[model samples]
Target: MAGERDGETLKRRGLMLVLSSPSGAGKTTISRALLQEDHNLVMSVSATTRPPRPGEIEGKDYFFVEPVDFNLMINRGELLEHAKVFNHYYGTPKGPVDAALAEGRDVLFDIDWQGTQQLAHKARADLVSVFILPPSTAALEQRLKTRAQDSAEVIASRMSKAAEEISHWSEYDYVVVNDDLERCLAEVKAILTAERVRRTRRIGLIDFVSGLRQGY
Candidate 1:
């Protein structure tokens, strides 16, 4: 298959693209847009102890493991990052992500700041984290209401949590205020494209340059 650039297929290590945001800040929507558009990117399926809600599939949405099995995974060091949120355990399994990276396919993480930190600690070179922010607190609250995914009580709780989540914006490599969806998405794609061509990630460049020197 052709690589990121057209025609020439130069090998490069894949990246871990992390998009984090408060519940109503549009990270999930941005993530979905990225996955739909980028063939090289795949979402990292997480294992969670939380029960599946309406229209959620077993392996696709989440692994949906029992708490016992999740603990076992933690003990075995099979999870890259694990955290308890809203009384349920959620974690990223290590195996699939590793395989995808090795094959030059980027893995996208729709995880929190805590999980982003863990991934960075484990593989700093491969991680490119972006924190998405809403335009305003009132806009964020309205978005939660518009989505109608959560009850009024739940939306209130999320609004309370948004401030804390937004505080971690400095931790990410890039920050995007998602006031305009198209602009935000374009900026994200620009970031990804630039990161892909960085010298460290382009391992095949060594051989390509060597060939050029020989020809000269």
Candidate 2:
């Protein structure tokens, strides 16, 4: 939505904002905050083989599907990216994302490095990726424990995997070390604000400028 106030309005193409992080790195928290604040951004609803949990809505929370259907989608190239986690298949449906992009509505993705890599391959021009890192390993472990949603064994497993996930930091366009939640969220919002105005992303800037030249 960033634009200059020339004679005409500048239109911008939508972007795919991706946030990736190791478990307990605060990417989810940041994503949630961004969604709450940004009315123009929508979360990419993924399809999953897992059944809906309590209070979860179909199509909004996820497009609940059978494993066979998920595989069919993968085979037909209907998915932007698909991954198996904990024996459940999760993927982003290409149709909705494409529609949103064509309408100039930004799509936000809370996915891992693997999914991000797939999206980059398919739509690198529209993708703006950020990697979130915890301030320290101990802080990461502490945040995992504080959640209390996972067992000690699961927390330990996630901690073990955290190092490998952090290694992919170099793949991201921007990296934010989450020492403080508010500060990190502000940094991410700043990144999105700046990227929104990038010359290449602004779709009709050339025409707007041309119109300005004619006026002079």
Specify the highest-lDDT model's number: 2
Local accuracy of candidate 1 as per-residue lDDT tens digits, 1-216: 223332253677899999999998898889989999999999999999999999999878899999999999999999999899889999999999999988888999988989999998988999999999999999999999999889999999999988888998999999999999999999999999999888898766776677667872
Q: Cα RMSD (Å) between model 1 and the true structure? A: 2.9
What overall lDDT, based on C-alpha atoms, would model 1 receive against the true structure?
0.91
Best by TM-score: 2
Candidate 2 lDDT, tens digit per residue, 94-152? 99999998787899999999999999999999999999999999999999999999999
- Stretch of 10 with least lDDT, candidate 1: 1-10
Residue pairs in candidate 2 whose N, alpha carbon or C atoms collide under 3 angstroms: none
